[model samples]
Target: MSYAANFERMGRGFDLAHAIAEADRCLLCHDAPCSKGCPAETDPGAFIRKLRFKNITGAIRTIKTNNILGGACGVLCPTPRLCEKECSARFQSLARPQGADRPIQIGKIQRFLIEHSWEQGSEVFDKPEPRPAKIAVVGSGPAGLSCAAELARDGYQVTVFEARPEPGGVLRYGVVSYRFDLQFLRREMEDIQALGVNFQCNSAIQGKESAERLLKNGYGAVFLAPGLWAAATLKPTPEDIEGLFSSVVYLAALRDGRLAEMARRIQGRTVAVIGGGSVAMDCIESAVKLGARDVYLIYRRSYRQMPAEPDERIEAQEAGVHFLLLNQPVDYVTTDHNRLQGVKLVRTRLGEPDDSGRRRPEPIAGSTWVLEADVVIEAIGNRAPEESPEWYPHVKVNGQKLIQADPASGKTSAAGIFAGGDIVRGPALVVQAVQDGKVAARAIKAYLDQ
Candidate 1:
């Protein structure tokens, strides 16, 4: 059986009738809280209102005006945490004992309009004539792509330099295919391309000299969005042993079609994945699809505190993946051949709130234990690349090692250079990165106009 065939999209988009019904559910509040909750500030209320009135083209244009990657945002964004969570109907339903009112399916409706326009061969966005000033965008993730699109629309010549063979960055490589199809991403990229933004694939900008060369070559500005490329390790055992792998590397390999070689080596073996975020869930699902006999999702936090969406966790559970909560891996129990064995873990408990507002997990002193594991995948987190400071000597960074820039403008320490997305804010949602790119584009445009 083809593993790709078995993996399905997370949700089917809404049809026209259902999309209008969901749009009608919106109260059309004067000050839409759902729009406020949206990081990309797509103005969900206005679009839904237009959609309700059967103005499909206008609704899509409104959405694209704020979020260049509106289609991908519809599928990838955590709606429950953002727009839906702040819906007035959701609050109203909560206030009333039996109100039965729910937040409008804003994401589904947006997806419907965007996908519908694409299917009908209608215009989804308006383009402007090219200007004289040129802008160079490094990276092809949401941030780089969004920034490039915005700049291109303003008539500024925009060229996105991507390190990978293909663009889309995380949308193509980091995310699991089941969450969103490659065709969906391809369509979104085509929209950006249609806006006159040029994509230079297989072009990696390594250091300050690379950026300086762009400036020397008449590019007025540069936006660095090289995302968090370094994966957090399980100290002292981060090496690529016969069975050890980082979730980031593993997922990228799976996306690049290279995981099959490694997957076949561990067929029917038990796999233990460590983390509590959506990426961990992806790892679990991918391992299952790769024919792993048993998959265990180990997290140091409780279920309620998991960073992943509840629906995602539910899907994993339904797929027969085991959830091992409140467990922290301390050591790798390797075989004498140093090939593969298991992992040693310690029980943990939630403590006082940490800087992130969630309760910190404390490892119990005597709660160490070993679990069976043919392979161990660490999905803890990712870090900024170590060569960043050296790569951009002029830019400043915070103690956390993230780029230091104004949140409002995405302005960096150096003049004519801006930064955003994972490189600046650390690993975050795609919508947030899209907003960063939009903000940075405006700032760059303002600087150029001055």
Candidate 2:
């Protein structure tokens, strides 16, 4: 079975009439709490108002002014937890009938308007002139792209270096294509390119010396937004087994068409995914789509405490993925030939709050069990690449290896150097990284002006 053939988008966008209706539903609150809730500070009120008035180009400009990747983010960002959650209409609806208690569909409307513009072949935003100052951006993920777009708009000669062959880091290589279309991502990159942002793919900037070399070569500033690509440690890593895989590696393979090429290798096999985050949800769903006979999602925490978005879990469940919540993998059960067999698991109970402010999972004694697994995928989390600090020695890193940058500015300890995205904040929302890039662009401009 072709895994790519089975992919489907999670959210259905609004039609033109429905989009207009949704745009009209926005009270266009003066304060615009919805825009404030957005990390990228997208002016939903402005865009929706423009859409309401049938100014399609104006609406697109209003969005791309703040978020260059507005189209992709319209599908990727969890609007209910962010912008829609803060929508005034939500509170206004609470006073109405029960069934009518719904906020304006900000994400869908944005998706419709932006997509409509692209279909029309209309310019999303005006191009900016190139300035004398040259700046280098490491990574082509949301943060790097956002920063590059914003800086290029300011007339800086910006060049983005991507380690992979493709421009989008996680958005292109890690996220499932169904979640965010690769073509849309490339189009957005093209938009940034239109603004004079040059992208150099397969160019890995090694260490601090390499970055220093860029500075020596006369690049005014450097922004590090290379995201977390290293798979996080799974205690008693099942790597010794032949059928085990890391979630990051698995997704990358799937995104790059490698997994589909080898689809026969995993066809009809029982697959178990370990973790509670959105990545795990993607893994299980991918497994099912890849023709896994049985797909199991094993989570150490309860469903309520799962780090994944609520809708993501629902989508996975609807895709025929079985959930084994409150179960933690202890070890692997393999055959004498070193082939994969099963996973040894133990029951877990929620305890007091942990560092993440969620209830910690504690193992229950004497509750060991085994679950059959032809293949096991660990989707727990990702670690920052170790090459980070070594590449920019002047920057400080916390215990987790995340770069120490100002939350508001994305500035590092070293002048003319900044960092953001997963490298600074660990794995976070793409919108948040976009906001970081916007902030970093302003900071870099300020430094250059000084």
Candidate 3:
């Protein structure tokens, strides 16, 4: 089945009655734990209360006021592990006789409100007076959108430049449709645009010359929010294989609804996915949906050490993807014609804790295994664009090639040049990017005011 067919089967939008019923369960706590749990401080209690009161518009406004990407967040945020996990209602339930862990369905309620607003064509925000300074925001992802929206609300003219044809960066291209629908993302983009943030699509900034041009074009400040787009270096392997791909390319194809092309590459094949993060889950699930007969996710560490959410791992398993933990691929084996036939994997064991606190993987001696698979998809990780530093040399960088900036202010080494999102933090959750944008916006406003 095609990607669209898959979603059609999954269904879209929530039932309003069910949503309100869930929303009504909220105790409307004065000191909302859900809000405290949220990195962006989204008031779940307030929004739920509004939804319970049948004030859909008010609920959306409440959410979008804090998170410009609120709609997408409603769909993709791991609320069950974040906000919902800490909900007072759940705690109250735990204290009852027939103790049930029941958190008010905050994310679903937020989605309902957002969907309602979309149906009614309700605007996200009202236009404000224009400020004197023009702010240039690079990359139209969540961080750039958030920064642009916040600055526009503060009455600064903001122009968001995107390298892709669409305004949303990763949200539009990198995320799978099952996680976040493109229509909702487009609506959010529209709302941002309504706030007076202009989008310039298909514009890539790769070097200092472009930076100088943007600076010369009357932009008082520049915020580089270009997310990590570069795929990590793959071990030298035979690409003459029938199906060898990167998770980013695979997910992008799925998002663009090119399922036939994607399926042609993996259908009826035994697939091996490298890495164990959300993207790996995406790859495994995509393989399942695209008709891959056998899908194996080979990670270098134990299941407990996986970076992906537990729920995601469960979902991938439910979809019939096999997990081969504590194994790392050493090389891809190929036939004489260079067609991929299998992989040579080395057994791994947990070593001492690394600097990141996770136990590092140590290769086990003489534990080599050869796994047969027609396809191998690498989802290890992503890095910043190679030319980023060359393009903007003034931008500070950490060891990981992530843009170095003050988390509190989003200011880079260069004056009037700030940055945020994955580029700054190195492959973080979307909520973090939104928070970074909010911080950068405030900092830009303060800087321009002087």
Candidate 4:
């Protein structure tokens, strides 16, 4: 299969007629459970109601004002577990069982409205008066972008610093363009830029002294949102071997325009990806698209315990990626030259529930095997920055190595500093990160005002 065929977005949201029809399906609830269920507080009920009344400008305004990344969230967030599930119209309009598209398709409708407003070239935001307070936001991911937009709307001078060569953080390089096109992400960043948020790419805040220096240089407050780009690697027997790739680096290669080279090597090869998250599914499916002879996803637990969104699983299955369940990899079966040949594995059985509330997989003794594979990608998960404490000693971290901050306010133990996004919440949905940024922006405003 060509990459172009796989690059197609799942859907192009909704058309004008379909959007209006879906909006009409909304019950216009007095209490707005759909809005309440949104992590970013985007107020889907109000926006859909406005859209239903043919108030396109009002609908887009409601979404963008509440959640800066409304467009991205509209496409990416798992509505089945979030806002759409809470819709009052689901029971009546959707006759399916167990979250089978029974809702009004709130997300698709929101995307349509936003895209329509943009296409019409209607001005949706009024420029705010400039304020003297300068705020430094680190990491140009969804959280930092959201915080910057909110602060700019409040008339604060906001500058977002990105460590990489370009901004957008995970949105720019971590995700596959098949699901999230870079052109769309660029348009959203242009919107943020219009809000007076300056982005300084290739600016790395090295240590605590550098951060303190920003405050000394008249920056009122610093918001840390450096996302979790560090991948948790597998400990192969003695040491790291060849043909091993982490999902972060693997997905990044595609987004960074290096997939052609990777595809050349992976063509007609056997590939295996380890984990049960969205990244794992993406790797496994991408291997298939890249022309791998055999692509397998090795998950220790059952399909029901997969942490990935339901759609990802379906997509992988449709793409013909094989699933190796109830199996745990013990070590790499390598050749004398140390190149990966296959993976030694062990069968597992469900034991007790682990900390994640999912049944743990216990290896069944004497049940060992080997799966042939030329390449392996590990997508187990990511870790919060381990150097965070060195960067800011006062910032506390929990047992999971994630930065600890007040849940509601996003304030850290350090004065004049706040944190959010993946750094604070670990790997989470974009909508949740946007919420963290919004909350932190509000708290920063309060601190500055006082």
Candidate 5:
């Protein structure tokens, strides 16, 4: 099968009838626990109520008012971990017999509304008159876009500067195609632009005087949301080999139209992926769809201990990925020409819980073994946050390199400078980043008002 056909989306959005039915399932509690559970505060309960009454425009506005990328989050948000988990219907379902409990499909309803809004060419936000004070947002990721969109709707001149040629930061580059296609992404980008938010691609913000420089120039306030682009690997990694790539490189190649050729060259060859996070899951699926003879996910811990979402792990399993659990990669053997030939691994046993609350994988001595592989992809996680900008020297970051901003508001130690997203909270869900941006937008507008 062709790569695109192989990676066809395994999930579908709700149709109009399905969405209304799902919306009708909402308990419509006055307290609305689901909305309280939402990080972006999109108020799923309120939107569902509107949809139940057949007010689709109201539902769409409710979402767009809160989240700029409502459609994207509808598809990407881990609702089971967030809103759906707190669903009152699901909670009350415990009183019934087994196989009778299901949360209101808020995410799918949200996605349907967004697509519907596009078809009607409805105005999500009226274009506002430009204010005297302009805003500069670095990094056009979810956080930056949300911040920009919010500020633009409030009459501020918002210009987003992206280092990459295209916007959508991780959403455009790192996200898997099977789940989110670029067409939807482009539509969202256009919607943000409709709000009068300008995007300057290929304009990078240097670490030196990043925020201060913008403020001193024409910009009145600055918000930093540069995502963590650096991909991490094992501490003592093998020398650079030709057949090895980092998760960032591997995933970017998939979206850039280069993976098709790479897949053809590596067809029928063994591919090994390391780590146990969402990126690793994406790599495994891409490799499988790419037609690798064997795609092995080499995670050091047991399946139960994987950092990737439970649902994600199940999907990877369904995609025919071989799970080499309880195996820790020790080193890689390369051919005479420096191409990766195989990976050496040692058996691992679960030990005491570590900082992340998962049982640490302890390598067993005298149990090393080698597995032949033509390609190796490292998706362990991310490195420390990228270098801090000289503009905010007072900004403090935790040991993990995450910016120490107020959780309630994305305020930093530096005055007139706000921060959010992966830089503030490390790698997280798109909804969290959206919330971070929303929070920062409020604080930034408040700061500028002062």
Candidate 6:
């Protein structure tokens, strides 16, 4: 089935009347905990109040003031766990001696207002007097885009560089289309671009040469926001099998309209995805959407311990994907010279908590079993590329990977060089990346003034 068909089956978009009604349900609490809970500090209660008052433009303005990527976040942020989770209404309900009502559907209402404003061609930026400095943002993902937009609004000349032919980075390539449509992302990018932020597509900052070139090209400050691009290694020989793939590669293909190629290779077959993160859930859902008859998500931990967002896991389950919890793939079972027939997996049990405070998976002896499948997709995690530190050794970094920057300012060790997003925090939520970019933009502005 086509992507549109899948969305139709999944109920694409939200109901406008329902959203407005939900917005009216907000208690509009004082010092709203929802806003405080947001890493980006998006004032959910205030925006919802604006929506309730029919001040759509004001709501959009409030959101864009703090988060340029608010359009995307309105649709993609895990509000159930962040904003809505901390809603005072839920607390009030609990205190009522009986269940009163669910928390205000803040996320859906925010998405409705933002999407409606964009559809109505409402202006996204407030006019500002021109400033002196110019800043260059590498990677046009949430971080780069947010930085560029904020800097542009602050009257600074901002230019964004994206190695990929298109902007939006992982939002376009890594995120599943079912959850976030490309058209919405493109609209948001266009809105930011209209604010005088220039974007140079298919431009890569590979090494020191590129970084130096950007600096010499009249850019006052350079912000490196290149996200994690290297997928973590999977042990054993299964990764070398013809049908085995990484979630990054798999999702990129789907995003780039190469799903037909993937479909032809694994259509009408059973597929196995190893990992418990959101990426793994995306892989499983994508496989099913691409015509995999039986898709299994095998993870080494229990459902509670799975790194994936609970809603994502539930969505995957609703999409007919199977979960093999507490199981780790040991090796691939090969039948022919080039085809992967299945995976040899061992059941696992939770052991002592690891450094991250999550119980580690330990292999259960003699619990090995073979799960038949034609394709295997690994979705463990990803790391930042090595070229970043090599190009700018002065840039602070926690390890060879992970750009190290001030939590408040997003400033690196090098003067006039800032970093954020996945490059700094490793893989993280889109909203957090937006927060990083906004923080970096403010810091860049302050530094340039000096």
Reference-based TM-score of each model:
0.94, 0.95, 0.95, 0.95, 0.95, 0.94
Candidate 6: worst 10 consecutive residues by lDDT? Answer: 3-12
lDDT of 5 by residue, 243-321 (tens): 8888888888777777676687567999999999888998888888788899999999998888899988999889888
Per-residue lDDT tens digits of candidate 6, residues 1-450?
574366322234556788778877888788888888788877887888887888878888878777777767877888888888888888777667676677777777767777787778887666788887888999988999888888998788888889999999899888877778777787778878788888889988887657646767888999999998877757644356788898888889878878668888667999999998888888988888878889999999899988888888988899888899999888888866867888899999999999989999999999999999989998988888756677676776776478889989998888788888998988799999999998998899888988
After superposing candidate 2 on the true structure, give the runs of residues whose Cα lies further than 4 Å from its correct spot.
Answer: 1-3, 8-12, 235-240
lDDT of each: 0.87, 0.86, 0.84, 0.86, 0.86, 0.83
Instruction: Give a tens-digit lDDT track for model 4, residues 96-174.
Output: 5655546789889978877786788767788788999999998999999999999999889999989988888788888
Which pairs of residues clash in candidate 4, taking residues 3 or more apart in a chain or in different chains? none
- Tally clashes: model 1: 1
Candidates 3 and 5 compared: the better one by lDDT is 5
Q: Write the per-residue lDDT of candidate 2 for residues 256-360, one digit (tens) a residue.
A: 868655366577999999999989988888788778899999999999999899999999989888899999998888899989899999999999999989999
Give me the runs in candidate 4 sitting further than 4 Å from their true place: 8-10, 93-101, 236-240
What 10-residue stretch in candidate 4 is worst by lDDT? 93-102
Model 1 Cα shift for residue 38 (angstroms): 1.1
Model 1: residue 395 alpha-carbon error in angstroms? 0.3
Segments in model 3 whose C-alpha atoms lie over 4 Å from true places: 1-4, 7-10, 97-99, 236-242
User: 390, model 6: CA deviation in Å?
Assistant: 1.2
* TM-score of model number 2: 0.95
The local lDDT score (0 to 100) that residue 284 gets in candidate 6 is: 89
Q: Tens digit of lDDT per residue, candidate 3, span 21-108? A: 7887788888888888888767887888788888888888899899888878888788888799889888776567774658887877
